[model samples]
Target: MPPMVVLSFLDAPVVTGPARGLIHLARALPPEVRLHVAILRGRGAGPVPPLDEMSDGALTVHEIQERGPYDPSILARAVAIAWRTGARVVQSHSYKPHLIAMAVRAARRVPWVGHHHGWTAENDKVKRYHRIDAWSLPRADRVVAVAQSARDIVVHEGVRPDRVVVIPNAVDARDLSTPMTREEARAKLGIPEGEFVAAVVGRLSHEKGQDLALRALAQARAQGAQVTFALAGDGPDRAMLEALSRELDLGLAVRFLGHQKLVGVVYKACDMLVMPSRSEAMPNALLEAMTLGLPVVATRVGGVPEVADDGEMAWIVEPESVESLARAVVDCVARPEERARRVAQARSRAAERHDPARRAERYLDLYSALGVR
Candidate 1:
């Protein structure tokens, strides 16, 4: 049998960011490195069905009960699972998975790492999440940050700087992106060909700050620059943003298209992508839009500056300043040539920065260094 490796994440198969990253990494690994994934808890018993049938030697996934930090019983269960699967190394992502691995390390005796994937200190809920994160990171042999910005958090919270690995989120943008015709794509997406299009391509929530983006676009449209805004993705704040839209009199101009699975289509469909997130770890949506050659107008928070160079690739605005964002949007929409240049620059740069093959090779180096079985 190949050298077995155990991987643990919050979601067993399908999840938004961290889980998807874990899945793709397994596929990219050499086949000789056998893999298993464990999930701490789910809505009910067993692995989620569709993915359960799909997992095998290359990926073995499971779910189990867990309580507070470093729950010994749960960690023991994980160690047993790894042992039976012949796994010689264990890796974990997110909070509970990391703690359990840490708790049971004596028994498992396997080299392990924690892949921290969120902005833990920027807001309230995440700070609570980071308390757990802070507790667990030191116990691991390696600590991986999805962005340099993410690494800053742990280091500020006082994790040794040397232990942190800043490997960013990676995607195959070359396969995912295609150059688009603005007139044709606008017609396909049901927007009039000449109308200025601005979009916010994430959940309508506090952290994402979609409301600010919408207000900015509304202000731009009010200036007699024909404009339309699309709020793509569904979340708890959908109704709130809708109410704010009506109160702000941004009817028809701002359309809410909920939870679009084909987000790549969103990139091609919009003339510009706007992300005014108050905080982010490393935004996949923004990266997606850039890869598809859409000019991005986003807030300079979190890992955004790492990807977008203001005026070179995309416009970077301060968070919560509706007027500043409005000014940037108006400037771009007024000049067609400038928009095209910005789009081209953004597309090429996004591909260069976040290539999955390059990220996978980095993980390969980390795994090899740890002597992953």
Candidate 2:
């Protein structure tokens, strides 16, 4: 029997969450499955490390060079790759990829799977793209949502509830096990010894609520908590969030690390992980934090509560509420024993339920159900 060929499309200029998740899933998939990744590189985009290198040669990556964002030939190019690879199923990871997959299906009668990771309406441009995605998703044979909230959003967008399946995001526990101790990571990152550090590891965007995190940090400080904050990702709201941090007079206590490639070190350097997102769809950072054994304080939005139980695996707080966020941070900092207990439970839960291999099996099952032998 020939191996099942699954060709996936991604429009990643850099290694984003969906890109990383696809790579992890590809690596964990059984030997009977061959996963091929095609990344669309637009003109003037900065150098992105080869996906093959990032995947450590686990995937066959094809870089599709595009003239610009609106390149009409991209669809033909993607269709050619699908035919060449003999792909039984075509999966798409983002809005642009979703469009490409729809076109590919028109050209070839292969099964299409649209993977929805939720939308971040940071700007008008992004909202427009999301609208396009909503229009294209219902055409897919199956729509895989990273969270139940995401599944609901797609169902509301006219996709049949039966066609939408909820598949939570996952992480490989072995991949996150850092050899560096907490003190070593802190020293390497120049965080002073004995200071309580809370790290927020996501893009610095409005949806991520970095501004709210700043206010929460200020309030936590005012309430006598000596916790230092490290914001470890960069995005559109960097300048605004930086200015707000300065305006709040949080001078040296907050460190904007600006997109650490070795994010595991950032995870290891911090005493806890803080996710202050106003919205989320099973954030990869939360799963990574849980797997890495960092105590989490996340907002109760989207699929967050589905990943971590409040007061059991993590401390859940209300979204967009600076007061609630501040109180959770202060209280989390005060209770060391509770942090340890929750971290242990979170790690165990992550290992058991969110394992990458288990997630890969679920995808394989989905593929089999789609008639991909």
Give a tens-digit lDDT track for model 1, residues 1-373: 5554655646333356665565556666677665566776643445453333333333666766656444567767877787777666667777767776775566767777787776534467667777888888876788888878888887886678888888888665533444556566555566666556777887667889988877887788888667788888887889999999999998889878787655666666777888888888888877777776778888988888988889988889998899988888888788889988988988888778777667778877887788763
Per-residue alpha-carbon lDDT of candidate 2 for residues 1-373, written as tens digits (9 for 90 to 100): 7678899999888888888887788888888898899889889987655767766777888888999769999999999999998888999988999999998888879899999998877789999998999899999999999999999999999999999888788886555567899889888888888889999989888899989989999999999999989999998899999999989999989999998888898988988999999889889899999988889999999999988999999999999999999999999999999999999999998988888888898898898888878
Runs in model 1 lying further than 4 Å from the true structure: 1-6, 12-14, 44-58, 65-73, 120-126, 174-194
Give the Å error, residue 188, model 2: 2.7
C-alpha RMSD for every candidate: 3.6, 1.3
Which numbered prediction scores highest in TM-score against the true structure?
A: 2
TM-score of each: 0.86, 0.97
